[model samples]
Target: MAVRLPILLFRMGLGPAFGKRLLLLHHTGRATGLDRRVVLEVVAYEPNAGSWIVASGFGTRSDWYRNLRVEPKTVVQFGNRHHAVTARFLAADDGADIMARYGRRHPRTARRLCAFMKLPSDGSEASFRDAGRAIPFVRLDEARPRLP
Candidate 1:
């Protein structure tokens, strides 16, 4: 119930209030073909690429991660702004780099995230990189319209 609070806020058009740190993901159930929504933390935002990087704290076992693998096309709402996007799984190397940098920027949050994911973190670059390699990171890139 507490986890759904953010989704409710998003539905109330207050999601953007959280800025780029959090987003509401509108996805589909692969097997049920049903619309579903989840709020995820945005680890990194690439302004140039118009993409947001997020990680599955529960690794590949996460249902949202599984659903995204099957249907990458989806919608992401960063507060008031919504975009048509596709989910791209980042490589382990990229994850390592991102995690290392993220730890540098937000040491406490990074450590907390690692703990939540059941990954040990010593607040060191190598530890963060190792944790990254173990987790599943996804990039939600703004999808370009197909030429008709």
Candidate 2:
């Protein structure tokens, strides 16, 4: 499928082609218990905390989103580097804040993301907030190795 093209690229070690804007999420299927992969647009990258925030444009129905909810500990690929991470489901308020910031930083891309999700946005902060409230965001924080 056309949608799986990114996944294939990631598999081929061409993930660097997508740069920092896109990351490959490797999670386990909640029902099937099989490995699954999805490429999601990075809504925000927190360098200080080594976390990557992403939104579920399809809402809670997205398999990857739900998968992470069940198994917070997973791995993600940014370019060719893979890191163990823990998923943190953000609250609606946090989503609103991130969405607002994202809109301000990348207006055109934000509008396109909203449009793709069929959310009406006039490029106003309020509209972005509304869209954020409707969408679910997850922060993937890098997992720290446990000391023995």
Candidate 3:
């Protein structure tokens, strides 16, 4: 976890500059009532459709995802802007398809996905394919922006 701290801080700070693609997600612990925010790489957005898609590269092991399992509603922040969003956890089948598409568009992310999922990076398509299945994909429906 300590090794990941610097990377996490870097992502949290420069996320927006990377693109409109990175978003900061806030989730509240159902039991502890603690507010937690995580930086996620946003791979796709459908403005016309009014939705955005994100992937949990950390798979089901991520704390934020666990919090969401208990509390589906969350807050999202992107490029200095913030919104109250509802999280819809896509079914495993749908998540797999979305992750495949995401990997196709962002090959670099696919590599990171493999590492995050604890898959062997033998540089094989099969490894990547398996890694994709382990990650979790989510869609966010954001409401109007508001100050956090």
Candidate 4:
């Protein structure tokens, strides 16, 4: 229910408005080889590197995260643009840095996200870092030209 609505909106061509903040990830089932899709929030974007950072809010056990671990190649749709990208899991230390930086910009949302992820955090850098280390963060790097 929470994800179905956004998937519908993106399908109906309303994805561009959300742009880099949210993306639709297209991946394949590790065992089934069937296509799967999910809408995920963008934790951060690096313009120079053409990369988007995202986390498995449900931890590495999340289906999508597990699938990506089996096959790192995937596609991402942001707004009206689609890109072939590769997923790379970040190290715990790197995730901590990213979370700390994110907390500084969106403190409230960060707190809420931590709660939603069942991660304990008191808004301190250390807490956020610990929470980050507990979850899995992936960096999606553009692998090819934009899709039509």
Best by lDDT: 2
Q: What lDDT, from 0 to 1, does candidate 4 have? A: 0.89
Backbone clashes in model 1, listed as residue pairs: 15-79, 16-79
Which candidate achieves the best TM-score against the true structure? 1
**Model 1, range 37-104, lDDT digits (tens) per residue?**
99999999986778899999989988899999999999998878888999999999999999999999
Query: Where in model 1 is the C-alpha error above 4 Å?
Result: 145-148
User: What C-alpha lDDT values do all the predictions have?
Assistant: 0.91, 0.93, 0.71, 0.89
lDDT of 4 by residue, 32-100 (tens): 999999999999988667789998988988899999999999888888778889999999999999999
Model 3 residue runs over 4 Å out of place are 1-15, 120-130, 144-148
TM-score of each: 0.94, 0.93, 0.74, 0.92
User: Model 2 off-target regions past 4 Å?
Assistant: 145-148
Worst 10 residues of 2 by lDDT: 139-148
Backbone-clash count (model 3):
0
Model 2, range 1-148, lDDT digits (tens) per residue?
9999999999999999998899999999999999999999999997667899999988999999999989999999999999999999999999999999999999999999899999999999999999888789999998863333
What's the TM for model 1? 0.94
TM-score of 4: 0.92
Instruction: Output the lDDT of residue 48, model 4.
Output: 66
Tens digits of per-residue lDDT, candidate 3, 60-148, equal 77888889988888787766566678888877667656656666777776777677677665545555556656667788887653334
Local error of candidate 2 at 23, Å?
A: 0.4
